[model samples]
Target: MADAWLVVIDHQRIFADPASEWCAPRFAETAPVVARLATHFDDRVLLTRWLPGTNRNGSWRAYFDKWPFADRPDEDPFFDLVPTARDLTDRPTVDVTTFGKWGPELAAVTGQYPHLVLAGVATDCCVISTALAAADAGCTVTVISDACAGSSDENHAAALQVMGLYAPQITVLDSATVLA
Candidate 1:
């Protein structure tokens, strides 16, 4: 798809908050790359914020329970998007309540777009999850390597390999490769 939509995941206040359960210092590192891409392709960009919620008594709760700090109201902030990413969302930003964005929340927000160029924080989690989902939905998915930050470098590399092997539908490329 020549006309691809850029998708940015998470990069929210909760994740960006140094006090949050899954905060990553490297999230700030991708700011420049994300800003450049958004500037170049403003109309096509779609940013997503993770709306934190309770898993309740479900199986998912078990995982979240282990990290109860994330569920605290204080951990979820009003301005969750990184300042850099927040500026980019002036074009369009979707509030996704779930980990995987394949549901109606994103469908109602995204309207129609064939290509999904994904970037943002926690590559092994939200970024990886959304990439596979978007690719399965028939969109051409490409993960902007440099514009994405994982909780750790090893996790980021592992996520890339996992996505490459399992989600062959996705194309893994660095930000410069696509932005240039």
Candidate 2:
């Protein structure tokens, strides 16, 4: 896998706020190809950031209180981070909160990259919940499907058909086969 680890889910600012309601013009058309794969894999990118508050209660405050302009502030203005991406100097932006970004700061930030090349936005919630929680933490995943973006298009084709029929740990490549 070439020391994998390029996550970028939840490309924030309320999912690129086009006035929310989970707007998705293919998430601004895959934000410039995920900002050119975070500038050609700058130390293998990682850029998650979805910090809506309200104590983030069960099921994330019942899934943002069913949107419709749900405003759970205290600081989460969509937790911005999509200004062309690539800012984490030596790759270090984690800031998690469930919805598939399963704990321990993404296992202490990719603990040494066994594989995880997922991409961004609401593909059935936090890019299918962090590619099925990094394939149940055994790692090795690759959901890139045009750099990802959902909340429509049939919830992004039913979250890539449940991460290809019930996530056998993931492998739904595209986006030029994980940026070649």
Candidate 3:
């Protein structure tokens, strides 16, 4: 697994909290799998948090306007990684303001790895976005299906199918297969 890296995307309190409007269903189940993956990867594991800024442009500005509740306070716990999913590794956590983690900040750290195993919340959103960007960046990407939670089951399945067709470099598999 020397060339492999596990990237855990947006498993934050905002998505894990059932009361939150942006909650991702089945986060309770997804958390354990993410934790296990972190344990398996140890130093090779990297976590990403979505940190939206006050300033926005284009559709993003409209998006924020539509869902003002999505604007979390700077110090809100909603932005933090889920309790059980935190502290699994000592690796630095990457924070991004977009749906994908393949931005300049993350690219600099992940470019060295040839393979990336991804897990986290909203499988149809951030998970898929990051997977595609990673593949485009020349990394062979594998998305841990069961370890990811989406807004709904249908969306999760559809996103995986969409990602399957997006590129040959992206593969969707269960965590057990990758961990084995």
Whole-model Cα lDDT of every candidate shown, in order: 0.74, 0.72, 0.84
lDDT of 2: 0.72
Decoy 1 TM-score against native:
0.87
Query: By the TM-score metric, which is better: model 1 or model 3?
Result: 3
Runs in model 2 deviating more than 4 A are 9-18, 21-42, 46-114, 124-157, 164-180
The 10-residue segment of model 3 with minimum total lDDT is 105-114
Off by over 4 Å in 3: none
TM-score per candidate, chains pooled: 0.87, 0.30, 0.94
For candidate 2, the TM-score is: 0.30
lDDT tens per residue, model 2, 1-180: 567767787677677788776667678888888777766667767787766545656666666667636555635545667667646435656775556775578767677335787788888888787777667767778787888888778888888888987555787877776566
Query: In candidate 3, what are the lDDT values of residues 1-180, reduced to their tens digit?
Result: 566788888878888998998898888998888888888887888888888776678898898988788876656777988888678768678887889887777767767446888899789899998988878778788888999999999999999898888556998889888788
- Ranking of all predicted structures according to TM-score, beginning with the best and ending with the worst: 3, 1, 2
Ranking by lDDT: 3, 1, 2
Clashes of 1: 2
Q: Residues 34-112, candidate 1: write the lDDT tens digits.
A: 8898877767777787765544667767867686666655245643677777778565567655676655556665654
